[model samples]
Target: MSTSTLDLAASLRAWGVIRTPLVRLREIEPSGVAIYAKCEWQQPTGSVKDRVAAAMVARAVADGALPPGARLVEASSGNTGIALARLAVMTGHPFTVVVPENVTAERIQLLTAFGAEVVFSPAEEGSNGAVRLAERLAADEGWVLLHQYENPANVDAHAVTTGPEIVEELERVDAFVACLGTGGTLMGVGRALRDVWPEVRVVAAEPPVGETIAGLRTLADGYVPPIFDPTALDGRLLVRLGDALAMLRRLVRTEGLPVGPSSGAAVHAALRVAERLPAGSVVVTVLPDGLERYLSTRVLELDAEEAGGLTLW
Candidate 1:
């Protein structure tokens, strides 16, 4: 008889799946703020969602939601698809990811390489289009949808892994900054940190109201992830795609951190928070992913009003 298969989380950590550490930086001071970045983009799948995806698929297997040979389906910007696909390959499940056509080719190539079938939505409509299409597919096909938008596993991943790591590394974090996607990372991490220090502020960095950031959709675009509890945040701010991209450059040049646009937004927001706080207030930011995944867009360089009208944003 064959031995029982290994549990996904245990196997990963046992195999030395790297843990992202909190790296503290010299005081970019605003009186109460000391900036730190939890470089989660450095995770195995190149994004913080890797934790969410792993938790998601593993829970599905245990709960019988995703049976052996069950087909998993969902929507993504880029990083989520990549994360889910990598984990699906690990758990021996078949998955189909729906994404906007405008996402980075690196994301598509990585998803395909990891054995996920990708369906592209209309480019101009962005992630909103992908969301509608994915919901339609799930309804018609009755596929097991690991809806990251509302997935509790997404929040739990941050609560368990990301938040604790930050707390362990810092004596006191006065403010936490996160890129607002489906609001999972921010809400989850914010909740965990607040439990220890209720006064610690949580800030969200969102794409400029009408614009898209990475492959994420927004509340105004007509959907909110069920996992998102808006009251979780202390404040929310918008970041322009260009400003975010520029901050990525500064991060690499000034700090040697090559993170993605969402991460850049966090940094930009963190700096803003830093400017308003008292000296020595610990400010921690979660950078969800890296820039290499968006190389096709030249997120580092730009010309005219549009980058390339594709990956540029």
Candidate 2:
């Protein structure tokens, strides 16, 4: 618990809350379509979930449900847990994160280092198991449950922050691409884009069944977060883990951006969208996190065959 409230405030200061706009990639080879990335990975928690966590905690506090020093609790798939844990520490509240056992060891270690108490849910069951366990615990103790999967605050994060930032960054964004996890980023940004430019295509980069967070996949054997609406997206594409990893390497090797798996997935989707568009099309992709957290997995070592059976969960 050495991370003081001052540390959180200092971290927040390091990042200007009014996030910078998307930087246009004007230099791709055979440059017809331009691709830009909204670097949410640069957020304090190294995940876009930081916005949602901030929104969730602030909203709860505003509603008088969570007073100062109250405990916040939830189940997470790493990123959200880390964001909320940081929030709890900053807000003078405490938090317990219920997570599946199989999440990246780095994520678990990071969460623990941030002073969040961890409760391991069954890895086989995935995030849903954590959700179920969290629900029961919340019910039992009346904890302030920031149920992100269904929380409107999650959507608001993108709606108010990320969406506008993308629009401001790009001159003419033909399409928006992002990975679909809780569906907040896709839906919120989709709505904003459609409201502003109805012609803008909202592309969802979904993980293949094997690469998804367990129980979080509605297409496979899992539970869909209620907030997810298939019809909300203008387009949906499945990004393979191998192609995603390769793209991640490509970005790092070529563009010097060290992004994580979800960013890789979004970049793959961006390229696919770019392929179909006319010349000079602008495609913007949101990067969820940085690559520093993924080194333990040796993502670069994955070949097509080996990447196939390796579940991203």
Each model's lDDT comes to: 0.76, 0.77
lDDT of 2: 0.77
Q: RMSD, model 2, all Cα superposed? A: 5.1
* Cα shift from native, residue 265, model 2 (Å): 0.6
lDDT of 1: 0.76
Give me the candidate number with maximum TM-score: 1
CA RMSD of all predictions: 4.0, 5.1
lDDT at position 39, candidate 2:
78
